[model samples]
Target: MSDRDPSVSDEEWAAFVEAARKDGVGSGSVPEPRRRGFRRRPVRHEPEGWRTGPAWREMNGRGRARRQVKGVVGITLAAGLLLLALRPDLITDRLPEGFGGPGETAPLAAETARPTAPPSSEVFPDHPTLKEPFKGSPALGWANGAAGIEVPRAKAVGGMSSEEVAHALDSVKRFLVAANLDKATLRGERPTGAIKLLDPLQKDVRAYIHRSLDEPDENNDPLGLFSRFDPAEVRLAGDVVKARGRMTFEAGERSGEVQVHVDYTFVYPLVKTRPGFDEVARTVVRRQMAFALYDPAKIMTTRGLLYVLRMDESAGNSDCARDGDGFLHPQFSEDLINAAPLPGGPEIDPYDRSKDLADLPKACGTVTRT
Candidate 1:
């Protein structure tokens, strides 16, 4: 039933609602309404006293009360939304307790962004060894310890299929927009939650998409507050070798490590945040999430980017502190810090042997080595 009928489709109307791929964004050219075969309806003039006159007051006081009630209702709705946008805790703090197995606590925001839960002593899963593309393997033609380079630049090898990169970027863009955008962006004051697909067949399908303004993520977390997401590196060779993005927001942040574990169904490189937030510091988390893509029309109805199978986490920040310039830096690896990651982003601890892993609440067995 394609409701392309002229009468219904061409009806002149406006919607004050939200619509888009993620939320709080939408884009697409709506073809101009055709005037043919449609007669213009005359505007109804207001009755006497509607504006300056007092005909309503002379006739009945109930009508005046009704108008006042409507005004209050509209103001109440708008105020609620604004309050939600600014505070956001009405979303992020209500997550279902437990992440690993039964009887686990939340992994964030207790004791001032420092995790307080004890590590689970369950048997650990065997994480697949990380591949060293720059050295170690004969394929790249280099030795691991022979190079005394301060920064080990992992060469981008050929592994990600064209489809994988496309969809992965698709997922990343969706995640970034949702994480950083807000309802204030609805009027175009800021960027909206949306992604532009490159498929030629869908050129006219529209780039902007927004809905679920009040919807929360699977963990019940709100869309993040960062104003932007600038992807610095994206890679996926033989199991998502590396995919890193950076953003600087005012808060206690995190540092992430890399992984290429093969046991999972879909293995994309990930930087995840640790389970805390204390001081205002730049943070990064390796993103290793589990996901599935489908036709936009079908997938849009469900949780969409608000839902994901799994993700990675940074080692905790027990060892992080402010440097001399008042900028956050790793207490152990200050010399190895980078600008994009700030001081709290991922890549601080490679193996996550510190209490950071133990601090993860609602522990996921402490062995979901993404």
Candidate 2:
């Protein structure tokens, strides 16, 4: 009819037409109106604060990773420092040359004195096999047999000719080898070779040796003069014997007499006599003796033969309670375990050759090591 419904007011009709146009209801091509539920909701924007957003989370993650890395580095550093503190030798070994200090060289472990406290159970650590008899002993590095007994270059001293001094030193070395290193002598046999090297006129010395061998007691121990072991009880671990020491000559208390001082330490490796037993024990014997070489013209004494003026000896790892059976009885691990408590005495380092054997306390003492 009149281009609008008669019941509709003009304002209402105008609003309806504007709404239809906005909705594209009367366009050349009509489009369907969108449904209420079909419209997309506007995106909800998060807060702009850096500490509460994704960017903040990324930075925080990186910081946490860095802290973890730092923690690991700190732990490693602490462990390394603790290791260095506990074993300084490791550091010294790795350091470059000249790092120790100017004109300073690190001392070898073998050279340094390792004076340990008296053992509680055994005289020496147990070596269960004969493969390495000298294991855990300073003698491991010592020269074998007569090679260790190096004679000094002979020189005239106290009015003796160089040739005479040389001959005297040779004689002393031969006697030492015979008394200490000879296989037969070590097996409880009489040290005939050693005896022959001595002056025949010294009947007292010969008689004493013979008596000690024949009737050995606590006072007249043959071990004081010879390194003998009972063949029935123990045998030499190997053919090698470790030795180290020096010999020096000076003027004797009388004219035409050259006194040769011999300070030597001999290490003997022994094992049980039983065929199945393989336990190795070491006996350390240090002998300090003075031999007088008298001139035939001036002193009217035997030529080339050495006269025994003094003899002192100290032994390590031997049974302190043993009453001299003419052989050394080295204490083994089992012996220590089953035996009575060892007698108390001063602790001595058997490897310490710096002091004279005579200076050691003349008592049954515990040795620091074998």
Candidate 3:
């Protein structure tokens, strides 16, 4: 099955020998095949295959070492790439942010996406209902003083009975007092200059009077008179006290007025020199609340407290705290008393002789401060 002229020709062998010599074999060269060969070598057994035979075998070790070096280089390159991908900060030398600065906008977490306010009544089956019922004449109505009332919400909502209004006002005051006290304590503040002067005198005078009168000590005192009294209660007037004043509000570039009359009538339960238990228990709250109102610093504290109370008791113009009787009720919202404006008004006055607040409405923000 071999091809014809199986023996390599002498001329071809000579050319192969010359090529091998040029390739730098020192002395020995490929033998030229006989022109008429004694034994014919196969034609497929060409001289081309002879060049690679011994030289390739001899270089096998160097080739193996080169392959190993390439493999190591590849592994090192792959490891470096892996490290760069895994920990980018290592390559880029930048510290992570501790917390966002004022300039930064931090990415919101998943929890922040949840709703903050509770679902409104429209979404729930059973929820507490709020009431707001008020109406007025659009032209020259309560808001415009055609009728003698000057409440902003009330102008639209109409009038409330004296009892409901008083009760609501008292509740708000109690809540405010507690809040003021808490805020003062949390901020590590002490009584101010005015308070220090008045407070010490008040305590000393009351103590002397009680001792002189031979009042039972608080421990033995069946009646809690001294224990229950607020520091602010002072007899500014006679047994029957009366304070009359007026408040002015600027109504859309116009001014409006409301008359205010405050009366305090003290009842002496069994005209005795000593404090009575009934009096201690019954009047403790009233006395403290009265004192809180007396402080000169709290003149315009009324606005926020009153606003909140009104918003809460919005069931009609009538108050949530009204009784059948006409007289105002006095169930104080213990925490909210001090919020009411102090009786004397703001601390500073240019005219030392000025008797009443010249600009309370402005301070309350009910009207513009012209």
Clashing pairs in 2: none
Give the Cα lDDT of each candidate. 0.21, 0.59, 0.18
* Deviation from native of the Cα of residue 268 in model 3, angstroms: 31
Model 2 residue runs over 4 Å out of place are 1-128
List candidate 3 segments past 4 Å from native.
1-158, 183-305, 308-370
Give per-residue CA lDDT, model 1, range 1-370, as digits (tens): 1123222222231121211212432123221111101001111222221112111212432111100000000000000020122223322222122312221232221121222332221111111222422111101211111120112223221233334334443454454433322222312222344332222122111111122123322221111121221122111122222122221111111111111110001112212133331211112222223223223332221222222222233322211222111111221122224412232212222222234321333211112112
lDDT of each residue in 283-351, candidate 3, tens digit only: 100011111111112222222122110000000011112211111111112212433322222222111
Winner on TM-score (2 vs 3): 2
| Whole-model alpha-carbon lDDT for candidate 1 | 0.21
Ranking by TM-score: 2, 1, 3
Judged by lDDT, which candidate is best? 2
Q: Which ten residues in a row have the lowest lDDT in candidate 1?
A: 69-78
Worst 10 residues of 3 by lDDT: 69-78
Please write out the lDDT profile of model 2 over residues 1-370, one tens digit for every residue.
1222234555764565456446654244332211100001111221122111011211332111100000000000000011111224323333322233121243222212213432121112224248877754556556788887878778877667888889888999999999999999999899999999987655445676787789986545566668888899999897888887777788765556677877778888888998788877777777777777767766545778987765667667666555457677776656744665444545666777776554555545455556
TM-score of predicted model 3?
0.14
Off by over 4 Å in 1: 1-168, 171-191, 194-219, 223-281, 295-307, 311-370
